[model samples]
Target: MKEDSFLKNSVLLTASNITTGILGFIFSIYLSKLIGPVGIGLYGLVMPIYNLFICLMTAGIIAAISKVSAIYKVKRQYNNISKTIKSVASFNVIWSIAIGIMVFFLAPYISKYGIHDMRTVNAIRITCPAMVFIALSNILKGYFFGVSKIVVPSFIDILEKAMRIITITLLIIFFKANSITALVTLAYLSLAIGELQSLILLFIYYKNLSKKTPSSADKPERASQLLFNVLIIALPLCINGFLGNLFGTASTLLVPRRLASAGFDASTALGMIGKFTGMALTIVTFPMIVIMSINSLIVPDLSETISRRDYYNASLRIKKVMKIAFLLGLATTVVCNLIPTSLGQMFYSRDDLGAYIKIASLSAPIFFTSSTMFGILNGLNKQSIILRNSLIVSAIEIVCLYIFIGIPGVNIMGYGITLFISSSISLFINLREVQKHIYLNLSKSNIIIFTLLSILIFMILRGLTTNILNNFITIRNIALILITFSIFIILSFFGIEED
Candidate 1:
């Protein structure tokens, strides 16, 4: 890879990710309208189990492949790189298929006992195939990331998302599935189809690329050894992700049960969980769709910067990205706060979403900024720290949700409180570690200026969204968000230039 690997890959990935993220959110909104909240809640219930299974099966495949393949690439051992992917992919095929079989069989148990909703049985079973598909796709995705051929997987992901949207819509219409359970099950089936499409395309690309690349004639490593090489790197990451997701899945499953325990009926509980998690949380975290791409692609680049003791550059990059994260988060927060109803109505057509949206939006700034810390930690080679902090925070989340959601008064609102507290702690722990390594040299004056200017923008946004352009719900919401950020960026250029 060239010295400018990050720059080129970042640009390619940013465009791809932004496209896919926007589409994915649009798909979420579409699903919301098509299935309704209760359906979404049912869908949501099955997803965590699906995700946990996928994480357990394929969590570390990408990073491990990227690491091992990159090393082999640098050594000009193209054969070894190909062989490593073959080894890993082969194992994942058998591994994921076995896991999928288990999920299919255990769906009834999970739906009945774990989720406390037998309606989710079909959805859980439907999601099993997707776990296998994603498991294979991750291997190819990791290979692309390793060789810096980001465009392949990037393009494939966009296509996959598009396919998902089309497939789900078509399946529902074709089947005329009106029941929530049937609809949710079909959604997972669509996901499986899309993942399968993505995997097939990835394999095609891999084959073509391998055929063209010149191979070194050195003695090839055994398949088992090659698999070991990848697994050695992947195993720890797999454990970290699995454990973290274990906590995350628990937190997810607990919400509905906790609400039910608070005296809400099962339907009402699922509805609340759907409104908050599927709808409100998605709306609030919209900016992270782009910010997260930045976070993901920057790790290797930041790690390189840190390795060379280029603390100054590293700090500058951190400051720049964090500012973007903060500004985007702040802008999202303001828009959501001022016109939560407008946004809720515009996107979801639900007058009821305003309450959840308002509460969820409160975390936008803190959550988005903090979300980047994991990427920063990865750059700092603080893998163990990330694992530890994640486990600790997950523990905190479980405890908070347990206590808060059980209270009759707190109920759904507890989700918001838990989100705020967990994000704050994760931010604090990760940011402290970052500060110790690189003196961020953040400009206090700039922070103050930006904060003040944001207040002013909030007021302007308030007028524009609530009074002046309020009648045109879509335009008012969209234009106000765009214009607010436009002014902020222009003002920052003139008044708050950290550079």
Candidate 2:
């Protein structure tokens, strides 16, 4: 892809993510209010299982498709590209069907034994069919990413999210879902509607592309060979994803239990976990939508660069991306710290949202850095090292939660501390490994000094503004956000520059 194409695609994807993030944020706030903390807790409980199944069904085919398709496009092997997609799609369909069946049969046991909530059984079962649609949508998305036709996938993403929100909102209004079981079931069912819509859109796009593009006369690879190649690239990633998500799910599920052990009853513990995960963490990680979109757009470009042995350009790209990521991360962290309570109150109408936000904000820099580094490492084909790092940190995080979360007075705050520690370790491990392949021009002293200076300035300005505004929460929060954003922009212009 040309530089202009890369930039355009990145901007488009980022814009889409921002739009979707806003919608999702609003949806979450509404859902939280409607369902309350207990409902949010139940919703959160169901998601880990949903995500694990989705990951297994897709089996890393998305990345594999993007990588393989990009290589074939560069080589002008359109027929091979077609064959690859077909093989992957076939494999994914089979896997998705099998997984769906398993989920349908095991829903009762999973809800009862795995999550310890019989209320989730219907919701889990209702979500199983969506996995088939999700599998199909992902295959097409991967193909689009591979061919550098991101517009289709970006538009489809927005459409899917919109559909889900609209469907759920309508269902809630029409059925008056007052109970947790009804609301959760409706939410899961809406997911199926959204996935189905996405599948339809992608199918149309695929058919049109197939009709327009000329078929190559070149003999295609055997089906078994194509499947073998895809598995070779995808299996390791799938294992990494499965294991990582499994551990992540365990850690989250343990939160309410640990809270209960700390002194609270089951209901109160679930509510606390709900507030922490469903409210606080959601707001803290809002900016991640942009970062993750950029990462997705860059991975294919990075793969193409590596394929051409253009290490210098790749290094330049990595440095510029990392610098921008770090600045954004630091700026967001400072802003969150400055007005955590204001933001929490503004978004969730909860007095304690601020506390959880403050604790989670400490992980901002570490989380952002680790996430960006993971994408770069994947682009560089360092899957094994990434897997190892993920496993190690996940183990440490789980251990930390087990040991600290149940301690008296520790409670959910222990999860926050563990998040910071785990992300920091992962970031350092990734940075060290990344340096082996490319020289990173990270100005550690400058970043540290700038971050501290920015934080100090934000605190002083926010304090003065709050006093001047007579502690009007809304105005104060908006003023602080605008001021901090302005400062970040100014600093970017004067201090940070692309290499």
Candidate 3:
């Protein structure tokens, strides 16, 4: 592929990320307002398990869709793409029905143990439809993404967010004095509505594609082989997904219970967890939206290049991508950490959450870099390694949370320590995985360059936020910083090319 392909893909995906991130941040902020911190915490408490369900239902299918769709399209086997889609879609529907029923039946026990909110049982039940829609929607997105058709999915994402925002806003107005169960149910309804909109858009897109006559010669082989191939390709990815998301869910389940055990009331404990996980961490994750944008484009491209045996180009691109991700992550960490208090006041008006944001801010680089490594390994078919690394990290979190968090005197801070340790250990695993593929020899020159760049960014950001606090908080300040960063990236690009 030409460099133009990369530039175009990056820009489109970045735009998608920006739109989705804005929508997500806005939704979370307002949702927090609607439910209050305690309600939000209860919501957050259930998220990990909810997201775990989502992963189980849709994890491996996403990568499989992208991989198979791209490969089939390249080979002009349109029929194969259709066949794979049909099989996956069929599997998804059946799986959702089975899982949704099971969840509905077991909702009471699950809620009591996991979130201590009997209300979440209904929320879990309401969210069941998402299992089906999410799988199909990802299949659609993966197909378009693999074939490099980004516009539709981007539009779908924005539309989904819009619908969600509108629906949630209206529901909050009508149900302001409703019970916690109603509020929780309304939250899941918002998700169901959003998924419905995206699926409709995707169905239309699928319908509009011109049909072609498929050869009988390849039909049998294509139909019969896709299920096996997709399963084979998707299994490790499924495991990686399960392990990667388990900690988040486990933490959510553990936090409220632990806090309650430490003498905090149930509502207060839930509120604290929500403020930290929902409000603070949500804001801290904004920079990672851009990092994830890069990862979305990297996977299929890496897979394509590796298939063609272009190891040198693949390695160079991986390094460039990793460096860029690291820089963005580091800058975000330093800037956010420096102005945690100001940012908290400006955004959410809570000092506790602000402090939590500052502490979690430092994990940005490791989180972003490790995510990139997961994408690389997934592209290289090293799914087992990804799963192993995730399992190790998640196990550390589970053990730490049970031992420390459940101790008689532990509080919310235990969860924070767990986050730091789990993320740090995961980063090490990612680094080791990368070393197995390519040796990154950081000589004095590389170290000097990295250190100097870090110092320059930190000094600039810190000076603005500290010495010029008032000006730094202004919209103008943000615009200027973005403009300067844009210029710097442009100049650096040209300089690198020239060298």
- Where does candidate 1 have its weakest 10-residue lDDT segment? 490-499
C-alpha lDDT (0 to 100) for residue 392 of candidate 1: 89
Q: What is the lDDT of residue 234 in candidate 3?
A: 83
lDDT of 1 at 379: 66
The C-alpha TM-scores of every prediction are: 0.93, 0.95, 0.91
The better candidate by TM-score, 2 or 3, is: 2
Model 2, span 207-302: residue lDDT tens: 889777677777888878877877777787788888888998898888878887889998898888898889999988888886788778677888
lDDT scores in order: 0.82, 0.83, 0.74
lDDT of 1 by residue, 318-343 (tens): 88777777777777777788788777
lDDT of 3 by residue, 144-245 (tens): 877788888888898888779899878778878466667767988888878988898898887675353344345434555887778788888876787678
TM-score of 3: 0.91
- The order of the candidates by lDDT, greatest first, is 2, 1, 3
Backbone clash total for model 1 is 0
Stretches of candidate 2 above 4 Å error?
A: 468-476, 493-499
As a TM-score, model 2 comes out at 0.95
Is candidate 2 or 3 superior in lDDT?
2
Q: Report how far residue 471 has shifted in candidate 1, in Å.
A: 2.6
**What TM-score quantifies how close candidate 1 is to the native fold?**
0.93
Ordering by TM-score: 2, 1, 3
